[model samples]
Target: MAVATGLKQEQVVAAAASDNALERLHALLTEDLRQVNALIISRMESPVPLIPQLAGYLIASGGKRLRPLLTLAAARLFGYQGDAHLLIATAVEFIHTATLLHDDVVDESDLRRGRESANSVWGNQASVLVGDFLFSRSFELMVETHSLEVLRILSRASAVIAEGEVLQLITSNDTATVEADYLRVIEGKTAELFAAACEVGAVIAGCDKQACAAMRDYGMALGMAFQIVDDVLDYSAVQAQLGKTVGDDFRAGKITMPILIAIAKGNEEERAFWNRTLERQEQEEGDLDHAIALLRQHDALDGAMDRAREWGERAIAALEHAPESVLKQALADVIAFCIERDY
Candidate 1:
């Protein structure tokens, strides 16, 4: 199907090829991500030391660690040839972990990566406190880089991310929330960190402003695309791949693209069902299946998928301003993976 972004068939094929090449890029960066892991594990400490145990429990539970991997890939793409790549990579992971800790609390989530969430297992108090420790540790790692620009990039992202989380909290079940509002929230909460991840690499590599912006744009677009696809998967992916149930967003009262569009285009009876089941938060056992049917009726998932593809294309376009290298190719491949990945 042709998505609204109007990418050519070859572009889609190229994106698929890029997605396949991730195994090659993963092999290339295995050592770098491992170094980042070591640094991250070494720094998960506090004077009181309660943080060490709580943080360890969450961090040790395996995650893809994609944000830091993106940072490492960006540095490699620019031929950084320096040890700071690992430090910056660790910093990005710290930032990501901190957010996850906070996000579970905000979303009242029970499971993550097929296990109990930190907030569920360790309690919200420990999760919140440990998340603060990780954020502080991330700043410390940034200071080790001794680049004012890198610090600024991360600090601003952190602030924006906090704001995004707050915005989402306030907008829950708000039927008035539009697509643009959704974009703003995800751009701040999700994309800002991604932009900072790639931008920090350019700063570490001593790239000029233009190069830094290029990487930043690539990260932002990729992150946006990634979240949109994730929202779509909440409806489409099987429970095993998603590590969560279908209609999870509906339960959380967050109106994602598919839900929003479906609610808009559904028939009178369908709209009333959504108002009763979703807006009222009174979903019966069969409500999710009916909601899924509504999405199919409106073709909302396809629309959301198309929106994700547009963001992916924009992410690739952002790479045009970057210096061509294997690293850049790897980053491009990451963007492609964001769109094509089923989980």
Candidate 2:
């Protein structure tokens, strides 16, 4: 169950304290999310038992299951009561898992959720193959949904995700990657799937075009906030909570928000460090600290987080057409939590 992630009611309330109605909505959304998670696990395919080893390893790692939750919650908000929601929810989870499998490979990440990553435990080859398996499996499940419109949205989202991965790869280590470029990459990589999740839910509910569009906009804004926060975490979060070292992005040659902002504002010495560290991928013993200090000195991390909050507020505003209900309020709360949560 999605609830198996051990999301506490108190945590949700604390996460949503700024808005009372959202607390109630989060409670219901959590329950629906549990059902969606079960569906995802049950539908995941592993013809060879060994294949299941890595696939199950990652699937059972206790992610927040936000993507699937968004799908079910959006459908529920529109009064959908069909099993199609379950199928589509699983599809979303599969898509998300597939991305993670590939991401760990690309990032060479050793840890996730405080545990060894699948690539670390099972090997990169297995991780890549299992990731391919999940991607194909997601498409197969999408085909089973039988809604051409749903299929179209998911297919296009999948394509965009791949393109985003490629874009990030090309832009990696390039200090010239500005805010607009970073935004485009995250929108395609992260927000497109989110937008698709909400869109599919609205489609399943037969929602009007205006409401559907609203949900899409909400998802896009939420995802933008989500990615920005993730970038911030790379700089601000502790290793225990971040599940990685503070300067992991710089080590990986990825020019994230904090680094980009820092580069733009850095002086001659700081710019030289960035060039050698990122451009040359040569990190001396103290380079990480230097990068972190630069980010803090310029307030890039906090600035990016402020931008995330702004996007979260815009997301709440996009929900104006949504009915005044606890669920609507909770959707807004999730966006706020995305911006504020430590881990």
lDDT of all predictions, in order shown? 0.80, 0.80
Per-residue lDDT for 120 in model 2?
Answer: 93
- Per-model TM-score, in order, reads 0.91, 0.90
Output the lDDT of residue 77, model 2: 74
What candidate 1 gets wrong by more than 4 Å, as runs, is 1-21, 47-49, 240-243
lDDT of 2 by residue, 152-217 (tens): 989999999999999999888887788888888999999999999998999988998899899999
Error of 1 at 191 (Å): 1.1
Q: Which 10 consecutive residues of model 1 have the lowest summed lDDT?
A: 1-10
Q: In model 2, which runs have C-alpha deviations exceeding 4 angstroms?
A: 1-26, 237-244
How close to the true structure is residue 51 of candidate 2, measured as C-alpha lDDT? Answer: 72
Separate clash counts for every candidate: 1, 1
lDDT of 1: 0.80
